[model samples]
Target: MTVIDSATENVAHTESEGGIISWVRPKRVDVDLVIPVYNEEEELDDSVRLLASYLLGRTNEFGAPVADGTRAAFTWNIVIADNASTDFTWAIAAKLCEDFPGFIRAIHLDEKGRGRALKTAWGQSQARVVAYMDVDLSTSLANLDDLILPLLGNQADLAIGSRLLPQSRIRRSIKREFISRSYNLLLRTYCQARFHDAQCGFKALRLETARKLLPLIQDDAWFFDTELLLLAQYQGLRLREIPVRWVEDAGSTVDIFDTAVKDLQGMARTRRTLNSLSSEGTGEKENARAKTGANATAKAGAGASANPAPALLPDFRGALIPRKLSYTV
Candidate 1:
């Protein structure tokens, strides 16, 4: 991972006297919100202002709460991941950083791509909880409460907003809906991932877990989310999919056909990795001579002769599936 010393890394880590490491340490203040931007001049300013205002309200403008039993106020840093935008996006982002001081910051990357920008910004952040949402705010800032709730409640290591769940209300075209379903189905069949919606752009991860898994992911585009989730699953990290209300924004950069093909390719790669791991485990057992040759041969024969039926994949059973949201051109 490329480590750049940006304003976000100014937050220092604290150590305890007894030497018990605290993984929930907030580097700058509290939460680090990373938004990767690529030619989002139309929506960038509004989204950042909205997020800043909401965060300020939540922490009482970084002041002590006036009421009894209220939690202490904390800081939130907004990291704008500039993916080499050929627009006024970076200028506006820089202005926000200057205006907000320690509260907002911008990191400019000449390399273009959503995944590349996100990975750069995430690595530079020091918050206990690191999060990224789409530039258009299609998922809305209101749903952020649901995404962070699991992390705050200590029930999950990662949380993602799902537009396919029962409580979710997605607004999109039928063609997009059909393509999304087909992509997810292929992912489950080939990669054995339990996540129902792998393409959702709004996702949060515990800082420690993200630090460990982000490097394992190589994709720097739409496939980035899927690769991260797959690596997280392999490492046994807990994940929660919260229902969300997603409005399809016009002028989206997603090319449905191209993205679908890329997603399928990612799933195939994940499947190969899993198969390799399984084979390695079997090889290790064989080298140990844990069983007699005849027994091993018999077991191998049985495994080979056993039905080659594919493993049962997880069902999208936790919640009721919602209808696709219709969009007007």
Candidate 2:
């Protein structure tokens, strides 16, 4: 459980000679687009380029034009969360950052896994709105406006692109489709989760809401989304699900059997954790015990004082702060 502080100051230093600008202090933005990658070198470049081009032509929902474009006004930053790729993914990402200036930036991590990468990137970024999508772009960049619109309008705390809803169009093998349907059915029945899709990788969240819930997620793999959704529901957050067009990429890395088993196990884990917490008053006693353990550990460190204050964990069960845990799984 590593705690990261993201509220650093933003300072900009300019070099007059070459029109170069460097961020001397941490820079915050309106939106942070987090793309967690494993071995997505094949389609990474095209996906990023497309997103950059689209972002450059949009508006910020204030009905004002952005960058002289005919579209609505919007400002965003794309953060590529590199998950220890073994190919040229990092190099290509670096090149894109170099070529695009402030529109794109790449953060590299030696650890590999979707959840690990996303957690690291989200913790590091300083955006009001934080989002992540699949590297394959299966959800299509065209629907990005729909996902962000709810957040912009304050109608939703989190918005997810759903592929199993009435308005969604999915092109895939019948077997794969059946597996998806079956998984969703199981999730609803066992987990009591209300969302149509709990596994779709295209999702956006307000940074405040995300900060409240992301730390509660325990799974660091494909089941990360499920844990997030379940925790959000437990906390009574407002999550909006919107249908979107999605296609199965030819070289997708999804393994039906393995992923299904893992997802089920994760679901059971979630059920158990929630049940335990509910039974013991949202596990407050357990949390206190954990804090005491942490304090003891901290005291054992070299040159450490015996009476250190217990670090405060973010409370996800608060009232006024709606924990919008919405997503298209």
- TM-score of each candidate structure, all chains considered together: 0.75, 0.75
Worst 10 residues of 1 by lDDT: 320-329
Q: Ten-residue segment with the worst summed lDDT in candidate 2?
A: 1-10
Instruction: List per-candidate RMSD values in Å.
Output: 9.7, 11.8
lDDT tens readout by residue for model 2, 185-285:
88776766678888898988788788998889898889988888778777767788888889888788878799899999998888778665564553564
Where in model 1 is the C-alpha error above 4 Å? 1-27, 58-74, 289-329
Q: lDDT tens digits, residues 206-311, model 1?
A: 8887899888888888899988887777666778888888988777977878878887787667666655655565567566555555556767757755633223
**TM-score of candidate 2 to 2 decimals:** 0.75
Using lDDT, give the best candidate's number: 2
Candidate 2 achieves a global lDDT of 0.71
Clashing pairs in 1: 170-325, 171-325, 172-325
lDDT of each: 0.69, 0.71
How many clashes show up per model?
3, 9
